[model samples]
Target: MDWRSVDAALFDLDGVITPTAEVHLRAWAELFTAALPPDVAPWSDADYFAHVDGRQRSDGVRAVLASRGLTLPEGDPDDPPGARTVHGLGNRKNDAFLTVLHRDGIAGYPGSVRLLDWLAGRGIRVGLVSSSRNARAVLGAAGLADRFPVVVDGLVAAELELAGKPAPDTYRYAARLLGVPERRAVVVEDAVSGVAAGRAGGFALVVGVDRGVGEPALREAGADIVVTDLADLIPTA
Candidate 1:
């Protein structure tokens, strides 16, 4: 796909920019398994790949509970950090994720860096658009926070009342932050929900980095092009 028409790029954080993706998966697994009742089976990888990977924290908790034929009250977002409700579960996951991140410093995806550099060199404005509230911290730790001049992360999403991935709001916000129209921006994602959001936003290009999910899955999710790595895109400079 030709990205020439795109003047800006919006990127996801966990899997797209940093190795925190694995940390998220692990934390989810831990939280889900611990939350399961004594008689319930443990959380599986398929459960993660199917229900939670790309969703918001509260959404992820709800999805996993549904998988086990369970339900919980839609607790308030400010529900004190550990109250046993949906928000509580989400907070627990966040705590676990932060622990892992602090222990293991962020790792950058070489392919992603190459693509970001290429875009920057070509004068294409770039922004980091992620559902994670810790997007800034992750990028800062990885020494990449300065790479993108504009950042529209979970905090921005909350402030703008924008829905997360699969709703097109976050990507649209990022594009807006870059002062580019949706049709003139590219959204690069690794999650099914994120690619769908990009496509729904009518971006000039919806590129998918199929890190774990196969290429066909990404294509099916509305990615214009699926590449194993962003390095495949030659540097415009």
Candidate 2:
């Protein structure tokens, strides 16, 4: 991966660093299962890969509903759960996620943690870049709050008025915050939209961690390389 050329590394939160993607997928399923009608196509993991993964909560809500030929108003962020608005559904999903998170705390992937330790040993700056607003909570839950000095999640993105993944703005912003130029930073991601964003940002390299999204899709989405696990990237003596 031309590690010698990289000055910083940016990682997507849920699938790449930790298994929180499972929690998020369950939340999304719960929201859509209750929202979709009996005759309509049931919510499936495919919907998650296609519309929800790597998107901001509200954007994901709109995309999933659009795929089902359903439209909801862009309700305020404070909209109550099950209120039948974009933000409401997003909030409902968040509620489900928080419930699971609190019930069962998260942990980072061992291989990913090993890579982080290896990168630290090499003195490379690392940052967490994610579309999820709950990134901070998840990072803390995984007990990795200290590993990343710079984080550009949904909250920071909104505060900076940056666009989310599949747009490249968030990834670009993370690089800037880390004081690393686009050509000197590496982006590691597990979602198609995230791969596309890294590609659009013209980073040094985009590594795709295939959790569920297939290799061809990630490669087509602009991943420079694809591996089943981050552990594979570590060199052995």
Among all candidates shown, the one with the greatest lDDT = 2
RMSD of 2: 0.8
lDDT of 2 by residue, 1-237 (tens): 558989999999999999999999999998898898787789999999999999999999989888988888898989999698999888999999999999999999999999999999999999999999999999999999999999999999888889888999999988998999999999999999999999999999999999999999999999999998888877785
Badly placed stretches (over 4 Å) of model 2 are: none
User: Model 1, range 77-100, lDDT digits (tens) per residue?
Assistant: 878656879998888888898998
| lDDT of model number 2 | 0.93
Q: After superposition, how far is residue 146 of candidate 1 from its true place, in Å?
A: 0.4
Task: Give candidate 1 misplaced runs (Cα > 4 Å).
Answer: 235-237
TM-score of model 2 vs. true structure: 0.98
lDDT of 1: 0.84
Indicate the residue-level lDDT of 206 in model 1. 91
lDDT of each: 0.84, 0.93
RMSD of each: 1.6, 0.8
Scanning candidate 2 in windows of ten residues, the lowest lDDT window is: 228-237
User: Where does candidate 2 clash, by residue pair?
Assistant: none
